[model samples]
Target: MFLLDRPTLGATWGSTSADESRVDGFYLGTYTPDKRQIVLRDSSLVTIPDAWIEHAWSAQLTLLLKDTKRRAEGHYFNIPIPRQPGSESAYFIELADPDEPVMYYTVPAGWQAEFDALPATVTVAVKEKKQGSDSWEDAITIDTIKFSRAF
Candidate 1:
């Protein structure tokens, strides 16, 4: 289920070292099917090209974007919903709008119990792997601190 609907308001997340060019964060607003676009501001709706994503709710959504550097984006959220609803598509969105190694997710077909989550809100900064490696990492998203969930 899509938690965001109107896509009109955003909660800005701030990071230290403003000059270092850190990845900025903001909670997206909402989406509208009739307008064929998603609203990202108080009253602004970004028209996502019709050819970009079809059936976003049912499709495995991954945004092709470039990361100036290499790393795995981190996220922390709880989906309490059981597996009975069937495996809907998850979206890997692009925020930086880069052009090199695009940002994406690698979640495979999950078990009914593996990702059973419900009614949870989370915040985390998705970070990449080692400086020289071509892999991604799942770091925790807690305020400004980083945490891990897997072994």
Candidate 2:
């Protein structure tokens, strides 16, 4: 699950989406525990000699909270998502989507504002398989941070 990173260690996990496919533009991520490349998917753009390990965690948890909150009209905290295989936290939401899913994982407002104020490195770990259908966890894609110019 994204290597089970800790908040205190400096990171958060969550996502949210208003539309049906809220997180479509987000780049899929993974960790590939074998070579530690932190692979990111660019439609199979990576042809280098590197292996990918399934990363089932995320850089933030704002996506989950937002979606569930909106669905319940801001009544999601009370709900509890079951634990999915290869996941670090066990919120009420299920780790359902990995292919162009619509979800926004955001950091706290203040902290996020500060973090966003400067250049940052974003790590994205997506589950290779959905827990709903796949009885076995097979997340073999982890896309690490890359540089993108707005110009």
Compared with the true structure, all predictions reach lDDT values of 0.22, 0.25
**How do the residues 57-117 of candidate 2 rate in per-residue lDDT, one tens digit apiece?**
1333353433221111111110111133454321121122334223332322100111211
Q: Write the per-residue lDDT of candidate 1 for residues 50-96, one digit (tens) a residue.
A: 11101101112233422222222222121111122232321113222
Lowest lDDT sum, 10 consecutive residues, model 2, at: 72-81
- How many steric clashes between backbone atoms does each model show? 22, 31
Task: Please report the TM-score between candidate 2 and the true structure.
Answer: 0.19
Quote each prediction's TM-score.
Answer: 0.17, 0.19
Highest TM-score model number? 2
